[model samples]
Target: MNNEVIVTCAVTGAGDTVGRHPAIPVTPQQIAAAAVEAAKAGATVVHCHVRDPASGKPSRDPELYYELVDRIRASGVDMILNLTAGMGGDLEIGPGEEPMRFGPGTDLVGGLTRLIHIEQLLPEICTLDCGTLNFGDGDQIYVSTPNQLRAGAKRIQELGVKAELEVFDTGHLWFAKQMVKEGLLGEMPLFQLCLGIPWGAPADTGTMKAMVDNMPPGAIWAGFGIGRMQMPMVAQAVLLGGNVRVGLEDNLWLDKGVYASNGSLVERAVDLVAKLGANTLTPEQGRKKLGLIKRR
Candidate 1:
């Protein structure tokens, strides 16, 4: 078990969870506030994703991202910012034979186009989804081809931003290692093992262990499970010699029926880490461990 675990709080995600949870941050101000709260509650890193204030839907607006980042920085909090570069890849297909006729949810774009916000904000870390997957049981799909991932990984390296390779399945992890082998990623690579998402990797101890064992050597990695498996995965990740991630992004409930804020989630994670005889790393220590060069 790692003695120093980096706890990352994914503040707000780009899911349809605004109405589901009362405290799900919608506006830029709200998102930034959540980030600050999480930092204060002992999160070393904050993973952010902006939403359209008017409709409470996921947005790719760089202006909103700028505002969110500015607010977080101005708050005097020293949390590592990790923005999502996984947007603009949604492809909603039509009924049966009419797959060519895309649905309204489709927001597909090129690889670089998805990184516009990352390019503008220049956060300490940004995520690079390693591969595509059938998002859910619906007609929608998350499209991130191998070529797109290669391009995105290379660009993130060029930008001097740490790219957290998001591996949803074993195949994704394999390709992520391939990117490292091709020298597309930086010398010190970062990875996030995303588990329990619909139609993706199942949330189980064996699966998490398998993924953790297959990770590239010397890579800084974090693992998280969605919904009810969130806290369990926390212990699992730490036990497997990896970091931990928590917050409303992956799981909304603090308990059986209780909704959770990002801060509460981080607080719980901090306690869990301590109880396991491991301490959560501070922001500076996390930066050092992950080889992150904070921007501004």
Candidate 2:
């Protein structure tokens, strides 16, 4: 447990959060701006997801990804860019009456197509969701089979970009260990313990500890919880010898009736980490710690 913890802010996720939160960044400009703000407020890393400019729905558009990454780089914030390669896997089953026919909201794609943006941009780090699960409030299934994950990991390795392993459940963690054993991971693997997602690991001390205990040896890991559990998990993660992540992607409100800005969420996490007698890592320090070589 190092005293210095790297803080990552997942600024805006690619969920249906536009109408729900007035501050959910939509366009490339908005997303980049939010990322810059998060970096300035003490986030060493920024996890990103793009959305359609007009409809505000999640998009796999390479153009959008390019614009967003370009803007963040141009902003001069210098945060580690972590693009999401977790899209194009949404499956909303159709009526049982039409078994073979796919239903609405089924946007599944092959591995290469899903990670088209990562192939082009080659950010310092990109996400590789380790496993699939029943996702969200709907009956949607987020499919990430072993073969799909292997292909994605191979592509990420080909680009020489670090993969941020996102583990949503215990089974996901087990599969991640398998990847490590198979040598799919790099010298210093990076992981993110995503707690409190629907039908996944619950956001509690016991569950968090269990997940942390299961982390493969020598892996750099961070933990975050959703909604009201955001700040609490920040403290828990730090005390339990892991890094912390925060932002509107996992939480909408900063307090009882207060909607939070990305910067505010980051500031709160920084304060908590510092108060716990742990220092926070800068983007450069974080990159070094995570074994990510800066893209010239």
Steric collisions counted per model: 0, 0
Cα lDDT computed for each candidate against the true fold: 0.93, 0.90
lDDT of 2 by residue, 170-258 (tens): 99999988988888877788889999999888899999999889888898889999999999999999988999999888999999999
Listed per candidate, the RMSD to the true structure in angstroms reads 0.7, 1.2
Model 1 segments more than 4 A misplaced: none
Reference-based TM-score, model 2: 0.97
Model 2: residues with Cα > 4 Å off, grouped in runs = 96-100
Please give the lDDT score at residue 57 for candidate 2. 90
Per-model TM-score versus the true fold: 0.99, 0.97
